[model samples]
Target: MNGYDSALFENRTVVVTGAGRGIGAAVVVAFLGCGAKVVAHAGRDLSHTEGDLLSRVPQGARSRLTLLTEDLSQPEGGADLARQILDRTDRVDVLVNNAGTMGGRIAAGTETREDYDHILDLNIRSVVALTGALLPALKAVDGASIVNTVSISGRSGGSAGSALYSGAKAFVSAWTKTLAKELAPDGIRVNAVSPGTIMTDFHRRYSSKEKLDATAAAIPLKRLGTADDCAPAYLFLAANALSGYMTGQILEVNGGQLMP
Candidate 1:
């Protein structure tokens, strides 16, 4: 056995999309902590969190970090990003399709065709496209894994202004299971992380503290989840030593906000 075999993702190469901030960024950190080399992809040149936050993670950990910027909403963009990673690494053991967009005016007469198209393109299309583009790399790994970032809004109807967002995520959850089986033969596992209202920038934009408190009151956990809380699920899925047999499953991290 490898010296770091018990360390979960030791020596694995992990790619995290939309890793500029929030849960995506947290997942990147988690994978790095597990001894995996991380390729962080962001939609924009600017980071969602401070760039230095990751750079500060100790020199040894920082050595495993690489940042790539690409707009996944476009078909060419996804392919380009995948190619960039392939060019830099021999194999990718884990692919986290965590990059997505939310929020579209969903009120009656407010939803527009353009808004629907944009949300679907970013949240669903990009996930599908990127996964397809990276299939070869994932297949080459001994125990590769893919984790899609879904949302509880996908399972149930979302707030009044989230029709497109919810529908897009619903598609992600369903697609994740299908891909898991299709890729299993190649030793690649596919899964998803569906989070309920979490205290990320995404949630903060849609809700104020008072609003978040009221929403939390309705949840069983009596509080909103944090990015830190949801990140481990991705780490677990990425770590072959931990979740090698787990595939086609949706691990919800919502502070008990939504339960099966």
Candidate 2:
């Protein structure tokens, strides 16, 4: 099959976290277009933007879509989310742990223990815990893929404001590599996508529009990335025919901000 098949995920069931907005929403739409049954989970109630996107799916595809709401940072929440999906379907062909937060208050001596815990809980811990809970369903499929949304900060240290957030994503990147090897025997591939300055509401927590524009200008591509730009990497990883032999890899889609 082609790497970007229009029907790439046909007859597959994929679960995506944080699907109410940004990259998560984009991933859900992409998979749906590829004919996958998507379980879209968001931390809060769906917004008008998300609702509109969902409405665009074809009628026949509507039944293939399921909406879920839950805070995945909690200890029990991860497993609970998995159970909810398993309750509906016997198998999950893909698991995209794309839910994350930008803890932008971690300057020198500014971040407290609570701040550290919250960031880690949302970024690193939730990904690992949720994946562990859903492993069985994923393995039931002949070949499944797990995609984690990491950040450019994870590769290199972040600015003072993003210290803790960067650290948490770094842990995710490292853990993804390890899990890829451990799960290879089960025919499950694990990978991460590290994006830079995406044009999404995700940055509102960290800076104003003016500041964001200035940062975007600093990148070699002279612009910020977008959710659309980053979604294809996840699609690529999730397509078994395209990336069946790939695992433990980090795909950077940062508009040339951090080239390795």
Candidate 3:
């Protein structure tokens, strides 16, 4: 919705990883509203998140959403996801690399090598592996797009124990630009969206209410962003009509939290 071209993705098959909740759910619903068949991925068994997502989808568009399950943290996860996509459709119009997690904030003294590997594997390695595996399917479709979900923490160093997550996203942001240039010749445009202070389970789980309110107060917009506010940015990047000429770009969806 968001008043953009609702049918911009008509008949297209868009694959969105991490669609079980938050930004991923918002993006899936947006694509469905716009008339695209969406392949939504979740890390675990279908749960309340999927149920909640279904309720938000229009009845007629309900059938457009197909669920795919895979733990992107595992070494074989990306290939597993891509195999399912290829099984469903030969051509993939869009691929949203949104499957990532901000791990438990480990204090400096308590951190271990496993912590670093977990975040890097989920946030950066999975993206690279999935995209590489699906390259053939993406090539089958003209004007295909790869939209990555990066965080504002990636642009500026993260606060407190968020260094690993921030560093991983920074890799993704940099890789997005590199992929955009490398894939441009094949008509595949790669881009990223940097979201800030979005009110979602991400915050509910990791940030206390007082901390969130403090973040809201510091934002120039005087409020935290909602999933709806950031969803349109992903839609714009995925639809050719909106951002065909734009590539290797990172669109910040923050409410003036950071200038970059």
Candidate 4:
């Protein structure tokens, strides 16, 4: 939706985490296309960007984009990323807390302490740390927006081996609302986009084709979602011009799955 409104985000600064691929990449592209200066945290390395994000970016947009590789799953990962962004700019118009993963399907009974710690650290702690660290920058601008990437699993409980991941997402969902209340007076809107069964590397790594196909069949639309499908909701929530009165809400892009 680069053409959605080329000037919607003109002169704005957007920061997106886990933007090297999938939904994050699409969001980055959308913001860049709308003329926003973007700081993209491209996961732990640049390898993922080669034939994906890097190729899709317009040549002109490159001049306005900054890519950083950081392992947000680590203890200090979020703080590190915030420091990098702060070094470059003092204001952030939009902050997309989209860096997270299920890691892998570690069965509930078989999960170890390390597994639990890592999952919580990656999905929960990192977001809190990053957002807290960047509060100053976020508040520096008028009507700043924070769009988090939650999951439908957070509501449905997800499939096997995703208990922790689902719970973590639920935590973020609640946190979003709380932050919204706390930040509203500061003119910062906090919201989220919860994607369901998106056709991205996230599923490629964690789900089998048989399972994904079965899910698609169950959806009212009878199709799996794509990264592009979920990206626009984020833009809508982030752009004050599009959703100025919207905050502390979760937009589900699941093609009619779990209407509640």
Candidate 5:
């Protein structure tokens, strides 16, 4: 479980959004374990962090973690969060844009303008604002990396009632590549981790038990994924030692669900 070098990220600064639970929490813990000072955005409040992130992080590592809460669904939410981060640190060595949600299942014809706005605002706009605001901080360091969280649905189009969610993730998948190329000269590597059927609060809210079971049965591993299952991939893509030459790639962590 602890295969990574203990000091892989020593003295580095990593910013992880949506880090209060599930995959984001796992990624934060992994980076801290590797000796990185992590600035974690714990969603809209600290409640989720109390329930998930706080419990998983070790007491010693907690000193290195700076927890913040922000509602990234608002228009200026990402920029506001960036302001808070820049006020604390002058340079960011790694940026993990993991904040986003489906908002909810909206049926095709029943969707409203508000529904589209919520999905796109949180999934797309916030990411853009945050990444844009942090570009200077990232550029201050050498070999800075940005690891985005995408979805398998971006490639498969997802199940019923998830069209908007699927499309938003697809946008991120494409943006990851675009930013990788655009920022290559600045020494910033951009990549994404697309997960599938992770048994997180996300699925508990949107997916049914029967659907999850069926998804597990069809996968080559014959099991659904866990937050821990996907954490290492983010670590790999962020560390220059591991992925210095790798950028603009979407690392799929779906248990062989989608090979494309």
Candidate 6:
């Protein structure tokens, strides 16, 4: 179990949103390593992501990779992505909704409506829309599954300044549970992975080094989780042989930071 499973997803089709960088990028590499036909979806250019992924993805797996760019923040972006995927293939075996944004600290009266819109759109709306758009396709495939990327902030209702972000993720976590029940009969398993403080670009720009160090110290593991650490959880959740009976669950990858 320590070593990677090369043939776990021999011919599976996986769609990983926000695969441009950070955790999203790591998950894509994990899937590709397992012999999946993966579509890496990102809203921005793939200059750095392309390099980051290429270096990690084996030469033999290169042909199985597909880079997709679509802004999942917009209302129609989900439909557009579905169309794009369908045009290329008939079904998607795994859907990873990893595209998300770290919003500015919420100020009660000072925050603009656009701020809330942006945060909710990226963090929550796209997940709902994209999952809905892909529902039938997911059902068509055998052992299909959906893994959503959530946050620790969502569980605690956020820290001092991240109220809006906390709220959006909270909704995502709850929605994940509800979706699991609804899709269970369709043979689609839905689950969420909530990461603690991961050292990704999302934190590099917003989290101070001192703050990260402080948070790391608070964790029982005494370190922040890496994107690589969080990647395998998605595979575990998606692979029916591994988690066939698991659904509507939150697999926390927080280094024992939050026991719940």
Top of the candidates by lDDT = 5
The 10 consecutive residues of candidate 5 with the worst lDDT sum are 1-10
Q: Candidate 1 lDDT (Cα, whole model)?
A: 0.80
Rank list by lDDT: 5, 4, 3, 6, 2, 1
Task: Give the alpha carbon lDDT tens digit for every residue of 182-207 in model 6.
Answer: 99999999999999999988888778
Candidate 3 lDDT over residue span 1-260, tens digit each: 44556778998999998888888898888898888999888655568454647768877887888887888887778888888878887878999999888988877778788898788888988889999999988988889999999999999886788988998999999999999999999999999999998998888878989999999999999999998898889889988999999999999998999997
Q: How does residue 225 of candidate 6 score in lDDT?
A: 95
Cα lDDT of model 5 by residue, 51-74, tens digit: 788888879888899999899888
Model 1 vs. true fold: TM: 0.92
Q: For model 1, which pairs clash?
A: none
User: Candidates' TM-scores?
Assistant: 0.92, 0.93, 0.96, 0.98, 0.98, 0.96
lDDT of 4 at 158: 92
Worst 10 residues of 4 by lDDT: 1-10
lDDT of each: 0.80, 0.83, 0.87, 0.92, 0.93, 0.86
Clashing pairs in 4: none
Q: TM-score for candidate 5, please give it.
A: 0.98
The total number of steric clashes, by the backbone 3 Å criterion, in model 2 comes to 0
After superposition, the stretches of candidate 3 with alpha carbons farther than 4 Å from their true spots are: none
- Span of 10 residues, lowest total lDDT, candidate 1: 1-10
* Model with the higher lDDT, candidate 1 or 5: 5
- Model 4 off-target regions past 4 Å? none
The alpha-carbon deviation from the true structure for residue 64 of candidate 1, after best TM-score superposition, in angstroms, is 0.8
The TM-score that candidate 6 achieves is 0.96
